[model samples]
Target: MTTIARSEVLLCEARFYAFHGVMPQERKVGAEYTVSVTVGYDYAKAAESDEVDDTLNYAELYELVKHEMQQPSKLLEHVALRMGEAIFQKWSQAAYADIRVMKNNPPMGAACAGAGVNLHLVNDKTKKC
Candidate 1:
C-alpha cells in the first residue's frame, strides 16, 4: 500500500547515443542509443514561456545521460536508475525523476535485431520539505 497525490511536476525527455549492454560485443561495438527522462518540478509558469531559463533544457539532460552511458556498466537498468538519482542530487529544485535507457540492437549471438531494455527509475524527493 502507498499514498501519493496526483502530483504534477516539471518534466523533460531527451534521447542519447551510446554503447551499453551486458555482452562484450555489445559494449565494444557501439550503436545508437536512446534514453528518456522525466523530471518533476513546479514550473507551470516556465512551461508557458518556453524560455531557456524558464524551463529545463532537455539538451543538458541529454548530455548528462550521454556521459553516464559512457561509463562502463554491467546493466543498462543500473545506469538508468543511477541517472535518476544523479539528476535529483545534482540539480536544484528537482523534486523527483525517472529515466529509461535502451540499447537499440543487442548482440544475442544471432544475426537478428531486436529492441533492448526499457527501464524505469524514480528518485525520491526530500521528505523534509
Candidate 2:
C-alpha cells in the first residue's frame, strides 16, 4: 500500500498597517491588520534530507503576504483571496492554502477585539493527483 504524506507550514500573527476598508478615512489613515497563513505540502523529502531547499521557505511566504497587504482593498476577503492565489502561484508544491486577515478595532460600534475574513483554497493540480 502507498501512503500519502502531508505537512503544513504556518505563518502566524504577522502584523501590518494597510489601507483596506469601505471608508474613505480608512483608505487614507490605514489600519492595523493581522494576517495568518497556512500552507499544506509534501514535506517527506525535507523530513529525511533535513534541507531547507526540500521544503517551502516561510520567509518567501511572508513576502507574498506583505505584498498583498500593501495593496489597498475594500474588503478583507479580497486581501485573503489574493494572498491564497499568490501562494499557489509561487509554490506549485503547495497542496492547499488557508489564510486569515484581521482588522483591529473596526469603525463599527461594537465591543470586540476585531473583525476579519478567513479563506481556504485547494490547489487544482493537487486535486488531480
Candidate 3:
C-alpha cells in the first residue's frame, strides 16, 4: 500500500487594525483583528531536501493574508473565506487551507470578547487524488 504523508504550516494570531463592520463607529474608528491560517501539503520533498524552495514559504503566505485583509469587507466570514481561496490559488500544491478572522471588542452593547469566523477549503486536485 502507498501512503501519502501530509503536514501543516500554520500562522497563528496575526494581528491587524482595519475598518470592517456594519456599524458607523467601526468603519470610522476601525478595530483590531486577529487572523490565523493553516495550510496542508505533502511533506516528503521538503522533509528530505531541507530547503526553503522545496516547501511553501511562510513569508509569502503572510503577504497574501495581509493583502486580503487590506481589502474592506463587511463580514468576517467573507474575509476568512477569501483568504482560504487565495491561499489555494497561490499554492497549488496545498491540499487544504483553514482560515480564521476575529474582531476584537465589538460594539454589541454588552460585555463580549469578540466575534469571528472560520473557513476550511480543500483543493480540487487534491480531492481527485
Candidate 4:
C-alpha cells in the first residue's frame, strides 16, 4: 500500500541583491533585485507521514536562491532562467518552476528606466507535460 500527496510551493517577490548587467559599470555597481519563485511537486507521501523532512523546506529553498542571486550575470533573464535550473537541481521532485528577477533602477542610458526579465521552466524528468 502506498499513500500519495501533492503540495504547491509559491514564493512571491522574494527580494535579494545581485550584480548582473551587460556593461562592466553595471556589474561593478550592484542593484537591488527582486525574485519571484514558484515550485510545485508531489508531496503526497511526505504529507502522509506528517514529517517536516518529507516536504520541501522553504528555508533551504530561500538559501539556494539567495546564493544564486549573488552570482553575477550578464542578463537578468539568464539569472532568472538559471535560478529555475538551480531549484530543479536542488529538488529533483519539482515539476514546475517560474522565476522572475527584477532590477530596480536599471542602467538604460535614457533608453528606458528600470528593466528586468522573467523565465518559466519545467522539470523533464518524467515528461509529464
Q: lDDT per model, in order?
A: 0.62, 0.90, 0.84, 0.78
Question: What are the runs in model 3 whose C-alpha is more than 4 Å off?
Answer: 1-4
lDDT of 4 by residue, 49-86 (tens): 98868877778878888988988999887777777888
Candidate 1 residue lDDT tens string, 8-122: 3332434455656677776777666666677765555565676767755666776677678778677877787777767776666666675656565555665554454554444
Measured by TM-score, how close is model 2 to the native structure?
A: 0.93
User: Could you estimate the TM-score for every candidate?
Assistant: 0.67, 0.93, 0.89, 0.83
Candidate 1: residue pairs that collide = 9-41, 10-41
Every candidate's CA RMSD: 5.6, 2.2, 2.4, 3.3
1-129: candidate 3 lDDT, tens digit per residue: 555555888899999998888877787788999999989977667777999888888889999999988888888888888888888888888888888898988788767777888888888878722
Clashing pairs in 4: 4-44, 5-44
Candidate achieving higher TM-score, 1 or 4: 4
Worst 10 residues of 2 by lDDT: 1-10
Compared with the true structure, what per-residue lDDT tens digits does model 2 show for residues 5-119? Answer: 6689999999999999999999999989999998998888887799999988899899999999999999999899889888989988788998989999988999888999988
Q: What residue pairs are clashing in model 2?
A: none
lDDT minimum window of 10 residues, candidate 3: 1-10
TM-score for candidate 4 = 0.83
Q: Order candidates by TM-score, high to low.
A: 2, 3, 4, 1
Once superposed on the true structure, which residue ranges of model 1 sit more than 4 Å away at CA?
Answer: 1-16, 45-51, 109-114, 118-120, 127-129
